[model samples]
Target chain A: MGTWVQTMLVIMLIHLTAGTPVWAVLGQAKASVEKDRAAMGGQVQSKLAPGYSVETITVVGMTIKEYVSLDGTVFAVTWKGTGVPNLRLLFDAYFDEYLDALTELQNKKPRLRRPLMLKTENLVIERSGHARNMWGRAFIPSHLPAMVSPKDIQ
Target chain B: MAYRAVVIACLWFVSACGSSGGGNGSAGPQPPNVLTVTVGGSSVCRIVNQLCTQVTICQPGTSTCQTISDILVDTGSIGVRIFGSVLSIPLQQEVESPGHPIGECVSFIDGSALWGSVQLADVVLAGEPAVTVPIHVIAPTFAGQSPSQNPCNSVVDSDPRTAGFNGILGIGLFTHDCGISCEINDNNNLYFSCVASTCGSIAAPLPTQVQNPVWLLPSDNNGVILTLPNVPAMGAPVLSGSVILGIGTASNNSPPPGISTFTTDQNGFLTTIYNGTTFAQSIIDTGSNGYFFPDSTLPLCPMPDQDFYCPSAAADLSAAIFGVNAGRATVPFQVANTANLLQTGNAVFNNLGGPSSSFDWGLPFFLGRVVFVGIEGQLSTLGTGPLYAF
Candidate 1:
């Protein structure tokens, strides 16, 4: 199965079980703003760009912004909040790959203790925060639409 | 044990010298069981605020021993971990399952982890000898032997160049590195048993876990005392000290009357209240170069230096350290602009700090102070184990 199909299946499963369409952070189908507004229990707003649309959701004590391609795919996710959201829940199936990449990053810089920035063939992640205040951004490099830069994910 | 304790106590008064100067070059009745700690000595890699000591290792129990210098003395962690590339002599590898060697993935608060194998070696610290204890041998090859499913297999230091030090001597406030967590849980992922080329995550029994060689000592095993000379307000190129093994067991390491003792929880964490915010999981980590604490008032250095705080002026801050009990201490610390400090090419700074989740009283906090690390489940004159006393 294609990566999108597998991710779509996982999203469908989560929606079916939880009665809410949960969008994966980096690689799910573009979210239905109405469903997201209800599922997250917060306000949902969006802005359409030339090639992609940016949807912002404020909920769970964290503000998350998702970059959606015109064809309907969440290519990136950025979040800022008091505490880091569980990556397993945020990235879904892609969490394992993120972890693998993180390990490789540590191997390269064994003494790097702060300001984590990771870039892999498939993903890009940056995390920096202090106590009770955490923020980060993660994006699927291949899924990012044309004219949309990874820098825009932030 | 009681008879030995009695003998040591009697010798403390008879053999103890009254010299106040305890620098690395102290000429006053140097004990045979002692090691000199150079804060910023002849280490090839000049990482700032590092407390380093010399260690002698041998193949289990042989005449062959190599005294390796530049071993970082860390009170924040437990056990001895040496890079495989630095080892001149080979040690016997320990196995968990039949014909399967034990591997470990050690994680730090910084989100960095090390993948390595556990080997049995006779580790000599200062003049104390610990026979047949499990130690970590960091190597990228061993990481491949571990199961792919294992979380630690994902992270492996490619070479010793990135490791900074020859090895790390973790004589923290614990007996074992992973302790009961890895002992009872099979999925802890810290420990693994490799059969042939396939390694699987398994529960590492307490006896098989990487141990604190200090705890395995024949005498003076209660704890350790680290005394580093005072660095100037600006910074210093080099500083020196002594990492005396065993607390109260040795005359040179006994805590003075009214010595402040702050206890820590299972993970070696205490509480620190600074700037009206209470950081519940504060740790005194000598492994960390600077005093890492979160303070919004202090400006963060731009981009690459963002990990450290960059104040217009060196900010002198105070925090109250609260123990598990009612024990409390108010400590005054400083955080200087790391970028400007780096310009001077100084390796030891008294006012260096960084940004971290919780309060990390790092190596800078150890300067000019005699710090005692009380090991868990052990007894010292300061009361019980698992306490940081100054």
Candidate 2:
């Protein structure tokens, strides 16, 4: 029985060690899985969302520098773009970072091993302040319209 | 349930953010770097045989119908999909003018069913008018049910405010809400269908139908353009201006220059290029949430055991734009992992972007470049010009 329990369930670790409330701990994890059921229209031991997939759109009226700072790893990025900014439509990066983040939590004690939702929207830009500010690609200059006509198609 | 409400409130906050900064006129007028797409070729779509319009699609006094003026134009989708919440009763017609309510369950890429009443509407574009068009009443509002959706990813987030745009007037080269293909299984599920303008289950083996809204409209059925300006490398901090809705043609449109260019695939798709990668048969879709691809150079998200092959992490890469007859351009950017991706956490995401998927650029990709889409038509009057510029 001891060997069997060790191989299959990790929840036992929480009850035996963390000395935490199983109901609240398991509740959040269940909520995450239930979301897939909600998506499937009904239930069938569903695990619909394997990972996080998100899209981010950052709108701006002024040029602002983006930087990331932390204790150990210093990931500093100075980005300024006149041409369309990279929306990073790739969901892969997010899933990787998020899943890694989740894996760490999942590996921990009982209450910590909960499923999560990767719900992040692009940082918002409320209104265009004014037209005085210019919009164009930073370095390229071919966008000049030649005032051509519909007859030019020939 | 209360927690769901809280989540919904948060979702609204996020949507408000999507529409704000981009609309501010603070940025000066610069011709948005336009990508000209050719719009000339012919595709066929059968009008739904029996579906009702605005009729029965009402919260009672909510008025199931509104003039075409009230409709909003959306690019995120290929064709038109009207919501039931906005229609007026007088405008609502009976299903097939005789039979039952046609119902359908639309599945977004996020994998969720938007079950609701389905009907048709008379669409008037430019000046012409179609008597009855199959318009979807997506919201359960007509069914007397409050909205219930995954708050964080609902369509409302696409447009936070209802200021100018109301219902969608999709004029993409294809259809919106891709009728059935996005479904996981069981073809005959009628999520959004019509028996006679009323509602019915979708026909068996749902078809990934992408109806072109312009074709359904009474006039200017040719094609459309989305023109805006280009932003510099250093992005603006605020929103820009109204997204110009037409090519510079008629009095309502502005024809700047260098816009008359394009090529077409008989399959109703256009040939496009990005970062030196040329995709010959790419559909002009606005409804997609992000740019998607599995280019060899870009990093791939390693979503564990998922079919999408999405990497769990975003890859940062730089590539040049190729295949433009006018001139060539080089640009550098990062590709992030989107949902339903492939792989397990970190292992797969470490590799460069997918070498599998045909490249795709979603709404985010449109933000900076002025893309021209060529729609197929008489090839004579409907000459190849990027019908869209942004």
Candidate 3:
């Protein structure tokens, strides 16, 4: 579909679910992709591949992409651009788990200022970039489509 | 009385002429535009290949200056950010209203951030005239709120020891850190106005934003030339270089002949084609410790340091770099086993590399080469920047 039409549909969907709580994309339903865009206040563009679909949102200097499986579950999300997107909204229920792992990693390696590669039991988060240009991806191993690989998220 | 007069005369002569031109025959004064940069070597910065320098911060309009060392020299970012713990003198905080002070959250590619308040100060770089500009003071507890509580939720360094450097001096290719984006978008998430303990994102005008100290220089304000000596494959424990302010504006900073200049996009990004894939978000940053790019063929290190590559032997690699102006250059680089290099106890390496999402020519790329960073919208002999010439 056209981008303008997709954006309008996203906006209308957001308006319909205006009073609902903010939706997180990772491991959530595909419908939450529009809610994530609304929470970010960005424009949305959708594209379909073989077994999954990608929803991209552009806000300010950042771009976020949400990958949804054929079963309508968000399996992974990738972000790139100036600053990071709101991970609290994107990671949804998994935000605290990610934070705990990150804190543990920081405590272990106090002085290393390199790219982050955090892997928990079920969730994997990797970020790399510098100031003004940052990018990263978060995904769930079990939630990925059968035909999809982690490398395909980007 | 005569003995006293003799003693007084001797003291006068010694005080007036004892040390003038007596130290070394060929040693002359250093150029005002040159800032000596060091990697490791007695500096408290312990990270491998981390570039360090010193900057003088003074209270605005006053000579109450404090010079802090171990400040990271980062060409990947913009603006001067100092740790508040090392600052002795107080600086005027930038505010949007009577009760609200401006706080900033600068996130890095490493998934870490520096949270602090913006304050105006007289920044002295090398021997240049002090320029009063806004700078980020690294204070995670600014206004009694932590980074997690603030809008930007990321891993924030609380002190210099954990951060590996005293602060960062971002002499990149821009005038302001956020530039026009923060000036227009209130939800930019970089700048915020804090009241008591509550802070909300606010649109910060250009004048109030933290600025690149090099841009405010009276002359030599165009850009900087960072030159580091080449390191051997075995690496070195310490290395030294120079960051010459301005481009072609001084006798010391003139671009050498037979140089390649490539213009970047507005966001300071060039394109890199590696392994038959075109990565458009490539960047040259001294802040990154080593070359970070994606290559599935290279094996990764074991746990704890798995973020770095652990190849069996030294792997030779090459990539083609493309600028927005259709300028292209082919560059060859090497990636060695990180475990072997780290065990050598060397702080500087030209072959250390790791895995990353984009093609980042980190400090290793600056070695044995004189790279010039032309600031955006600034004119120089290399043409108007944002361009990188080497």
Against the true structure, whose DockQ is highest?
Answer: 3
Task: Give candidate 2's error at residue B38 in angstroms.
Answer: 25
- lDDT per residue for candidate 1 within B1-390, as digits (tens), equals 111111111112111222233222223456735667776655433577777776666667564555566677887678888887777677988886576788877655444556788998877765454456899998767745432334453444545456567778898888887667566656444677877656666788888989899898888788888888887777898887788888888667779988888887655668999999887767777887788777788998875566678898989799999989677999998888888887787788988887654577888889988889899889988878888898
Query: lDDT tens digits, residues A1-154, model 2?
Result: 5653343235444343645222210112222222222222232221111121111113221122211111111111111211111112111123234324333432332110001122223111111100011111110012111332211111
| lDDT of candidate 3 over B1-390, digit per residue (tens) | 000110111222112212232111112265778887887764367788999877777778776666677789998888999988878778999999675899998888776788999999888777677789999999989988775666677768888887888789999988888877778778778898987888778888999988899988999899999999999998999898889999999888889999899999887889999999898878898988888889999999987678789989899999999999867899999999888898898899999898876788999999999999999999999988899998
Candidates 2 and 3 compared: the better one by lDDT is: 3
For each model in turn, which proportion of the native inter-chain contacts is also found? Answer: 0.07, 0.00, 0.49
Off by over 4 Å in 1: A1-154, B1-29, B143-153
**Which candidate order results from sorting by DockQ in descending order?**
3, 1, 2
Cα lDDT, all candidates: 0.70, 0.30, 0.82
TM-score of each: 0.72, 0.41, 0.89
* Model 1 Cα RMSD, 1 decimal: 10.3
CA-based DockQ, model 3? 0.49
Winner of 1 and 3 under DockQ? 3
Angstrom error of the Cα, residue B79, model 1: value is: 0.6
How far off is residue B176 in model 2, in Å? Answer: 8.9
Reference-based TM-score, model 3 = 0.89
lDDT of 2: 0.30
> What value does the lDDT take at residue A73 in candidate 2?
12
- lDDT of model 1 at position B70: 67
Alpha-carbon RMSD, each predicted model? 10.3, 20.4, 7.0
